[model samples]
Target: MGALHVLSGGAARGLIARLREDFHQHTGRTIEARFGAVGLMRDRLLAGEACDVLILTQALIEELVVAGRVLPDSARALGLVRTGVAVKTGAPVPCLETPGAFKDALLAARAIYFADPAKTRAGTHLMQVFQRLGLMPELAPKLRFFNNGSAALQALSEAQEAEAQGVLVCTHMTEILATPGLQCAGVLPKSFELATIYTAAITARSEQPQAARALIEMLAAPEAVADRRADGFE
Candidate 1:
């Protein structure tokens, strides 16, 4: 059988990786997966990328279904994933119980890493948090942006080893939990919390619709709830 082509948001990477072998065993087909920012994944699908299955924000999946890019009845939500703060493993976890504390933590950090604001849900919300706190100018120099949360967290892990002081990252909670050498401090402060529902669907052009649906079922199966929760999916 032909491989199932998948384009997904970084938030689902860990869950998908956990299920890949099982899905392949059950279906006798391997998966070819590409994961990145939701916006970039949407753009890739719209740009004629070959995708049998697509995983992205629920709203984006709805939009694609409306646009006839994804089958209307094939979408199924994985779970809600929140925006969160993370630190390098073994580093001191910052207190972010309040907006003021969150702002202070950002100010105290030697650097801040996040996904591209223009291309990611968490990144955009994080920038808004900075704006609301009136620290945009002061934090601009310390900010570093990457293509997606996974990349930002990876860089954060590497940077913390070289720097003596604290570094902070804000991204999807799932991404934080999935990355090695990182520890999730907590979700964003209540006022700035962003919980996004991620969904998976079969593409309209899928050559293996049955396999695509099977993969989606595997990802959102009731039996996998504990695994999803462990990965920071609500």
Candidate 2:
């Protein structure tokens, strides 16, 4: 069988990778995934990138369906991801039990990293959280932006190893939790928490429609969701 191509966001990367092995084992099918920021993935699809499936936030999925870029009926919710704070292993975990504590923890960090707010939904909501906390002006100077959460975490890791400078990253709990040697400080406080529902759909240009639907169904299976929860999905 031809390999099914899937374009996905970073939040779903690990869970999908693990599940694909099981998928191929039992079904003798193959899946190839391209993962990155949701916005970047959407842009690639809009620019005519070819893939059998698209895995990303529900908002992006809706947008693509409206644009006729994905089959509306094929869309299914896979899981929900929450925003959280993370630090390199061995760093002191921050207290996030209260909104004031969350703001204080962020303010006290030596360097804070996240994806570009102008380009990623997670980053944009993070910016809104900062604004709500009245820390934007103070946090802006300490903020470092990257192409995606992975890059931001990479940068944070390097800074920690080389300079011992304390650093924190803000992104989906799933991505942070998946990164080796990174410890999730805590989810964003309830008042400011952001949960993004990730969904999967067959692309408009899918060459393997039946295979794509099968893979999407596999992703929504109870076993898949259990794996997702273990990876920090809500």
Candidate 3:
């Protein structure tokens, strides 16, 4: 068997890290995981990058399977992740309870941070939300896009030191809740909430198919259930 290289989206990072750690301790297998946007990882895989396992949005996994970049029948549903807003721990929390209020919050912020709409599922849906709310044109100037949740959170942390009113950050709830120095501003209004289902599959380039399948099985096993459940995967 060989070391597993997992390419995953940021929302699944916490659960994946914990699972990988536990699996390693139980089996002495090394897992090297790189987490980022699903679209980013999908693009890299399509361009011939080698990965033993790919954990991404379920839709993306199906697309890669069709494109022959991942093995068919090797997919495992990981979790359902919802998009949420975040602010510096001690900063004022914006009201995102209703569509109109959420729109106002976005308009009132000096600067806002989110994942790349083109590269991440949460961001992509959020773009639609902005358009639906008719805030895109007005809020465009204040928007800053990052690669994924972690990058967006990091930018939000830096923005805390900027002007008097801290910047608003929004991304997957899982990532926002996992980090320190950030306050969970709550998920989007029901009318605007978007949940992305994540899945894992053995890559087409995997040299250790058994090992990869074993890991995938472990992910769905009872031992890893609690971590996955707590991380927003259902």
Q: Which candidate leads in lDDT?
A: 1
Pairs that collide in candidate 3 are none
As for candidate 2, its clashing pairs are none
Count of steric clashes across candidates, in order? 0, 0, 0
Task: Report the number of the highest-TM-score candidate.
Answer: 1
Query: Candidate 1: minimum summed lDDT over ten consecutive residues — where?
Result: 156-165
Full candidate order by TM-score, most accurate first: 1, 2, 3
Predicted structure 1: lDDT:
0.90
175 Cα displacement, candidate 2 (Å): 0.5
Give each model a TM-score.
0.96, 0.93, 0.90
Q: What tens-digit string does per-residue lDDT give for candidate 2 at 1-234?
A: 778888999998777767878789866788888888998998888888889999999998999899999999999998788888888888788898898888889889888899998888888988888998889889888888988987887666666464535688998888887788778888888889889899999999999999889888887887666777887777
Best to worst by lDDT, what's the order? 1, 2, 3
State how far residue 99 of model 3 sits from its true place (Å): 1.4
Q: Give the CA lDDT, 0 to 100, for residue 233 in model 1.
A: 86
Positional deviation of 144 in candidate 1, in angstroms?
Answer: 0.6
The regions of model 2 sitting more than 4 angstroms off are 158-164
Which candidate, 1 or 3, would have the higher TM-score against the true structure? 1
